[model samples]
Target: MEESQEEIKRGLKDVAACETRISHVDPKGQLYYAGYNTDVLVGRVSFAEAVYLTWFDNLPSQKELSDFESSIISEMNLPEAVIKRLKSYSNSNHPMDILQSEIPYLGMHDPDLGDNSDSANRKKAIRIVAKVPTIIANLNRIRNNEPLIPPDDKLDFASNFLYMFLGKYPDELERETINKYMYLHLDHGLAASTFVARSTVSTQSDIYSGITSALGSLKGKFHGGANERVRGMLNEIKNIEDIEAYIQGRLDVKKRIMGFGHRIYQADDPRTKHLRELCENLCRRANKLDLYEKSKEIEFVVLNKKNIRPNVDFYAATILDALGIPVTFSTAFFASGRVAGWIAHIIEELNQRIIMRPTSRYTGKYGREFISIDKR
Candidate 1:
């Protein structure tokens, strides 16, 4: 059957790719994971607890939380061979590429690499989520020519990443802010990277391979990498005076502002409020509160002129910047939280067992004349 123009979805916007119990994004812009509103989950539960709930569809009790945290901490260190390979890449590759390639290789060390059973896949999921941060941090450290900092098992996940980044355990408030960033980004419906991960695992491939696909998808400018662009925009508008001119110039050229809008969000991103507060708090502590103030001015101008509000990444860029994370590594920081979502979707798709192979409309001419080599 021939399809009408109206029937085609250019980017699968508003399309339901598959049924999922993992997370839901309501039209009101609120996000829910397995039946719990994410807004409620942030301060109420630890990031590990939230991640466990995403994978298992229920909150963990005291014993389960202890065991889950222990399991995750146990997987934080890379295999010795992987560590040696990582040290080799400290020269040139982008952090995202380094991470994307190394994670798939982690499957090589997994005892359950050949097993597609639910139980085996679950273990693989935990390993991927926990180890990705170490991979991201080490790749970033080596890229900066800094000595690698070992992961501290005593600290929680976010604080340990803090130690890796800043070479010290951050203050309690800073740790809490990092945890919030991780929790809010843990999952949000079936985002592009999650879709890619799910599609790869639908072929019954190993979880590590699926995550590699997800990482590649996220490397695109429009997905997880947008946060880096957001950071760039923030850098470009260094002074409060430049924001209006900056936004105006981009608007005059019809340039798409990277972080001002979202496909699923209606009015405002529900995730931004907490992040905005956290961004402000961190900037104040760093005594770089101008970054937050400048951001607010940009938001006011963009909202008035374009009627578009900032998305999660807009404020997140400032928070990350305040934490001393560079623009280059922002996307990798995003991936640390997003890995949990990818794992959740991969697990759900495998359970349902439906391959996500969407059909496309062919627009090219169907027939053509063939010419022999001597026809010319």
Candidate 2:
């Protein structure tokens, strides 16, 4: 008789775990948020509007948007204790590490801690989205021995982050670039970090714990950190002449190119088109047009040789670089935007009321008998 076995889907590839109405990642490279095409949402809505849509399942009216924006801005100031805790960390500490460590402390200061009611979670979500940028910008400033810049209530969400990070109001182009960039990343299908967030909340945990777990996952190079890796790859090539040789050399050793392919999206990532345009314009304005040209050449080579298209991380790196961001802080920016998506997923997972426990295939010998220690 043949032994019975179960087929294993490594990495849960193509396994449908649960149904969600929040976003759809079509295998054909189209993305929709709450049934509205991202192409329509990208320029039409602000990041705060998109966050409202993700959480509430529809776009908000003018009055509602104003109130929502005010709610988020009101919570932007961190607690004194949390600020003190952030100041104590070494300047050498990675920003994501600082972010992960400080979240629980933020939860400590939450008035609604331990309350998982929908209203309470909604309030918690606002706090998470509002303070994440403050945390990242403040940490960067602290590392540079600069005094922390307070969030400006006058600016919108994306603009305020830029103002705090750079210590000046952004021009129109810079503000639009960040708005589109962050809106594009608001959510995708069950990405590694999103899945980690859903899984954490599946145990009925608090919102902060789930976000902390997601942060740890996002810090890996293959995930959110890919943007940072892409920036490093760009720095490695000295000039346009070095592009082809560098790509072929990496390919020759069977090394994975940091930003050329995605686990999903066989065609060009839908988000890439917007980001490519943004990168080009921002690079030109920042006098880094040379970087944009080199990025295009690298994309052409990787596509011609490997037949793989560049993902969101590829151009997103250049966009941040053009904005004067250090490569080390790239993923923190990613996390800052992505916390909105993570919060939405946590809310959805909590509603499912089912803990996420999957079975594993046992490949080792299962019938081996254990010998007593005395016998040995």
Candidate 3:
């Protein structure tokens, strides 16, 4: 029995080698990519540059960056079939669900689906990244009964997304806010949904199908649901004065605050600080400093008394609120950024060609006598 137990442990420890490059956490739980710290990257780089780095593994020259932007902008139109399929979903269906269906539909439209060579795969990756924003923006427009605007090649990726979603050019600050938000959400350290994407692709599934599965996983409450909950919590509070009492009441009942905790970073989430700063600047510019102050008050109360730090969703709610992005569309916007990382991982898995299958330990007896359906 001891040897059997040892065998079980060994079976459980069988891990697969995936070639997809992922940044490791240092002792401090800080994430890095290819020798550069995320904090440094966030400070020094535009979101477009970060996405380029994630795909190509190097910073682009000015010309290269310009060409990259132009390439993505050129491919930003979704096929008409995809748009028609998106319209079939009810207006009340979650945007993420619509996204899940739309991604697989994209696979059907991809011309190079049969081409597995590296060059073809790379081009497909670019198309997926470029078109995901268009797909998500179109879904939002359809749900709201608004007219869908085709992508404008003149605008950068983030700017075009803002225009498509809002039907006008975003101001400089709004454009920057969208860019930063997209950049920050591009990837995390192999999150569960990301892992799901990799695992699906590891089975040699197409990239769009893998990402569709990932979108379904992300739609769950524990993953992408926090942002929506944060908006809901803010709505419930309704006024600045009610925040403390409201938070205290929730804590008294041992309820989980929507954006207070994180599974990976036990201290504070590093991503929160940059977004918070952006929110602060935006609020100041908009002459709505009072709202920012109220949010900060809640943050102070939550941190000092309960030892909870606001995660990305807390500040994301504020940033989207300031930019006039509706609460329901926030998670879909998150998907727009994340689809790049998903495509990257999917392509990486296809290159590595490793199957990800884990063994489960059986807790019940292996053999049992068959019984009649009505047996006592």
Candidate 4:
């Protein structure tokens, strides 16, 4: 039945589109993938293993994990043609714009471009996953006038991203840090980007197109850019003393204090716990605990003053900053993790073979008789 506008749920809040075995963000705000708790999976399972779990709904044994990593590394080396094309993009373009625009062209370079078979899509998924980090890293390198670095076959997914972006291997701890970041965000329950990706694939579009759709969805400030905004907020704070001033100032003006709330998590975002710890440790290691100190003050003040909890982006901003990632690329780096979820959802949508079309409540004027130009 067609319902009135008031009956419609804005943003599809509390709506369930389909059942998924891939992952769950339960009512209590706990996150799990393939029945394994996220806390257990992250730091314990490789990002590659996590990807395998998303695809197969089971953890990969060591042998399967090795094979998956091998497949991804072999696909990591982008074609020289793609490299030349990437070099031609204007340095002034936003990294997400460059990333979104490059994906379709990258799809053209794929051998399985039009093949929508499950096996073929999985192959394309692997390639897309492998190349996204490269695309993100190289695009920024071009912008900075730095020579693009190729992927390292010896490194795993996270380490290679650091290598490609930073032009050297991070230490094991640093490498593991990036890996954990990637794994922790591998899949979530039907986020906007995942929905966009799934909807694009429901039309029989290729994996690249699906991911391109997701990148566009993620480019929005609300969905994926919070971490970048958090970094900006931290920068604006400048010192620990300014934390309360900034928070109260925003509150006074009825402006959102970014990273303090979530649509899904009731109190605190589950991901915030690890990222908070990681951010503090990194700050301590670098002897640059000012940002961490400022962030804690902000969180404390916001919670007491507003009763709002900090989401993942709150601490993640400091964590990524502590690890030396530029604020410009923070969201794109977010896309790097989110792409795994996008792929998983795309695969699920295609397998289910349901085209997603929702009804809308139109409130435009009722139909009237049309008049010709010569009507009196």
| Best by the TM-score measure | 2
Pairs that collide, model 2:
none
Query: What lDDT does each candidate get?
Result: 0.85, 0.90, 0.78, 0.83
Residue 291 of model 4: what lDDT? 76
Which pairs in model 3 have colliding backbones? Answer: none
Indicate the residue-level lDDT of 269 in model 4.
72
Q: What's model 4's TM-score?
A: 0.95
| RMSD versus native structure for model 2 | 1.6
Q: 1-376, model 4: which lDDT tens digit per residue?
A: 3535656888999988876888888657689998988977668877888889898888888899889988887787777888888888776667888888888988999989988999998899889999899888887677778988877777887788888887777887778778888887787888888887888888777788889999999877777877789888888887788778888999999998887877787756778788878778888888878778888888899999999888767887887888887888888888888888888888888888878887878776665779998994
Pick by lDDT: which candidate is best? 2
TM-score of each: 0.95, 0.97, 0.90, 0.95
The C-alpha stretches of model 2 lying farther than 4 A from their native spots are 1-4, 367-376
Give per-residue CA lDDT, model 2, range 133-195, as digits (tens): 999888777777888888788889888888888888899999998889889889987989999
Q: Of 3 and 4, which scores higher on lDDT?
A: 4
Off by over 4 Å in 1: 1-6, 90-92
Q: Write the per-residue lDDT of candidate 3 for residues 318-360, one digit (tens) a residue.
A: 7777777788777887788878877777777787887888655
* Candidate 1 structure quality by residue, lDDT tens digits, 1-376: 4543446787898788889898998868788989998888877787888898988899999999889988887888888888888889745568888888888688898888899899998888878887899887777777777988887778887778778877777788888988899988888887888888889988877788888998899878778788899888988887899888889999999997777888888867889888999988899999999989998998899999999988877888889999998778888888999899888888888888777777766765645788898995
The residue-level lDDT of candidate 4 at 327 comes to 84
Model 2, position 190, has a per-residue lDDT of 93
